[model samples]
Target: MQFAQFDVAAFLNAHWQKRPLLIRNPWKAWANPLEPDELAGLACEEGVESRLITSGGKQGGGKLALERGPFAEERFGTLGKEPWTLLVQAVDHYVPDVAALIEPFRFVPDWRIDDVMVSYANDGGGVGPHFDQYDVFLIQGLGRRRWRVGPVCDAQTPLIPHEDLRLIEDFEATGDWVLEPGDILYVPPGFAHDGVAVGDDCMTYSVGFRAPSRAELAEAWTAHQVDAMAEDDRYGDPDLSLQAHPGEITAEALDRLHGMVLASLADRDAFARWFGHYNSLSKYAETDWRPEEQMEAEEVAAMLGEGHGLHRNPAHRFAFIAAGEGVLFFVDGVCRECRGEAAQLARDLCAGNEWSGSPSEEALALLAALINQGSLGFEEED
Candidate 1:
């Protein structure tokens, strides 16, 4: 499906941090990745996470049922019988088709791309009026849902029925619409909205945006930088003089300390590389297996020279190969060039797929070495 040619850059620059705008049928003849039956089956799986919430009384008052990860289908049976909704988070990473549905939106920064959450609802199923802290694009995939949204005026406004759900108290609808399959709704952070399923079954895909607070960024980056710093560089006073200003941290000293931390992340290439690696790492659990034995270098060289393809493990996010004078690695949000043949093999591994044919001899050799080192293993592709 071709997406609507909206000026995304302009919209992001203008309304991204400002207001909300709904775009109708953003994609042509939009199709859902998974069928209802497939979704139901997935909900029943032991490893798949699922939840059901029930609401009663009115549009604003409802009871919520909060469940954690790895839910089985039997758990949801007989629950949320009426006036309730079922929401499943991180559906994209599990379902390739759903992941593809969100790929077109990569025009937005990857860091801002959160998981695709699918919500299934029965007749009268609706989560009470509420506002989200992050921007989200709601696409109606099946059946119909009624949505109402209002502008946010305060950040500290108390919301949520329990510690888990954040429901708004007084939500004045600035807009009201019934979403049919293929219809889209864009709600910015703090816009209050309520959606009710109008029929027996309804599904909505929420493409959420990530809004990392300043504190969050600082915390993550600081830890990363500290780990990369050299040992024996701890803070200390070399010229100790007896003075009465023991509690005072001088501005110059504070500035120096800040510089030291910032210096670790100051290199543009380093920062990008780490961010890319961090972003690509899988958040889901990986299957376990033992590594394969190492192979001969000559055999590997022959295979690589034969143009054999190399592939990465679906569950492995970061892969590095030693190149000449440096190591080639992909991390955080960027890629880095490393020295030696190992780096070359790593690059080859990062680029290959099952369809790309067999791994080159050189790549095989390197993989064998990594396997021998217990750094990698072979897991059947899902």
Candidate 2:
């Protein structure tokens, strides 16, 4: 599933986050990974995030309609002839082949990589003209789609009034293309674009990247720091001196107060550790990924001894950072300090490769814990 012909470094320099680029059939062999029926089936399952959008049909009565799912299995058959699209979020988490699509895009940082959202649109169907706050690579999976790219948009841009959809009020395309299977369109943040199905059975896999807003970072990071603060760690002025106006706060006092706040927040080491856990959090926090049966350390070691490798769970995120003589390994919202063979194992696991390291007792214990917690699993032999 690797790209047949493409320059990763060139794409990043020229087009990534700068503008749009359309790539035609870049894969070694382009094959539709999931069928249209299979996608519809996923939309009907409970706990799966999905949506059905309709326009100019009985469902919406000429206006755009948005319905959240897990929809009834029979609902697909009831939709009358109308432009409509079905969107399922994080499809790669549930589908293995779909998860494989992310491998080629690993040129991007793993932390910036978000889940793949797959959309199935009928003829003339689309979600309408809109812009996303994050970068996305839209891979045409089945059939053809007409995609139009427009100028960059921002918060100042006006939108057509709709309850759920944030469609642009007026769209003027600067670029247009009809993409077939295996074609990819890279859309950067703030760029307005629209895609409409040219015919039936049109599916597109959108591989999105995470772009944390400043406000969001400030809020989350501050909250995390606050939780660790002691109650007695309040502002103090032991060096206070007599002032002309007792009520007036002096510039020196302001500097001290501001410095206190800034100094606390400026702990890069603490922030890095916090972000490792924050970024590695499971997308579906409520969905438990723990395995049914916990494996013993001896059993896990034996399996590794027998040449079985471990694979990371697609639903969970893994990352690490150097800390002193070891690495702080973060996975599924939990962090552990790994040293020696355990450190090597953490690096290997985060690489998303089959774990094939020489197993030590410490490493085996870590592996058993990960397997039990559902962050890693035994790779199946072919």
Candidate 3:
């Protein structure tokens, strides 16, 4: 699913995060890759995050109604036919077809990607008018959905308080449109918007991005620095002048105490490496994605000799940053040092869906290690 007709530069310049933009049928021919039944089946699986939002006279008219799931098999059947939606998070981690939908959008840096969330709805159904703190591309996958965009919202904006959801209290639509299959709506962070199914069997594939807030970065990185500190790394002003007034702490002591924390914060190199490892952590990090039989160095060498290429797990996140004569490559939050051919191989693996090249023995060693960890897989090409 290549975006042959879309203009990447123009979109970035005019609208990347500036405002909302509507791209009508960007793909050559938009064939929806997942079925409603298939999506429903995914919702019923345990450990998969999912939710059902319902509204109408029978249940309740959009005031506050939501159900978290791994739902029962019969749950979908009981939702009636109107005003209900099922949303499944991180669908790309489980469905290859859904994962492929992310390929065209890789123009957005791979590291910044969060995950793909797919939602299905009956007529007149919506989660409600609300604004997200992260940017998202709402891609219409199955049927028509009437979408309305409102003014930009901020932290001071009022929200309808509910135990389960944060919905906009008063929404004033400034733009409205109906999206058919293949159409896409790009909304930036803090932009209020709502989408409702105009007809039955409406499906939307949302490719969301991560945006770390300032407070979050401060807290997380501070914690990382704190954990790295030595037990004896406490503030000490050894030049203790005889205190004229012991009850009042000296100004010099306060400055020395503050400098202790500032010293750690000033280490930009350490922060960079820590952030790279932190952000590369995958959503499926806790779950084992490794192979049952680990590959040995000899096996990997033989496979590469046989012209088999390496394929990364769709659930795995791979990235690299340039270091001295080599690059520090990351897989599922862990870093590996690779130089020369191995460094290039790391770049290649992260750039494309498949990796193939005449390998160095050193590169093969790293590949063998990755294969054993289940971060990458080797298979024969048909």
TM-score for each candidate, following the candidate numbering = 0.72, 0.96, 0.95
Model 1, position 295, has a per-residue lDDT of: 49
For candidate 2, write residues 48-123 as lDDT tens digits. 9999998867654667889999999899998867899999999988898899999999999898999999999989
lDDT of 1 by residue, 118-206 (tens): 98888888777888778888889999998988768466776755777777767779889999898888888877888889996799989
State the lDDT of candidate 3 residue by residue for 1-382, as single tens digits: 7675999999999998899999999898789989999999999998889999987555555464899999999988787765888999999988877888889988889988999999999899899999999889999999999999999999888999889988999999998999999999999999999999998989999999988889988999999998888999877768887989889878898888888879988888787777789888888667788889987888888887788878787788889888899888998888998889999999899898778676888988988888888788876456
Name the runs in model 2 displaced over 4 angstroms. Answer: 58-61, 380-382
Q: All candidates' lDDT scores?
A: 0.67, 0.92, 0.88
In candidate 1, stretches whose alpha carbon ends up further than 4 angstroms from where it belongs are 4-10, 56-61, 69-81, 228-231, 236-270, 285-382
Give residue 248's lDDT in candidate 1 (0 to 100).
Answer: 87
Identify the candidate with maximal lDDT. 2
Candidate 2 — which pairs collide?
none
Residue 148 of model 2: what lDDT?
A: 100
The lDDT of model 2 is 0.92
TM-score of 1: 0.72
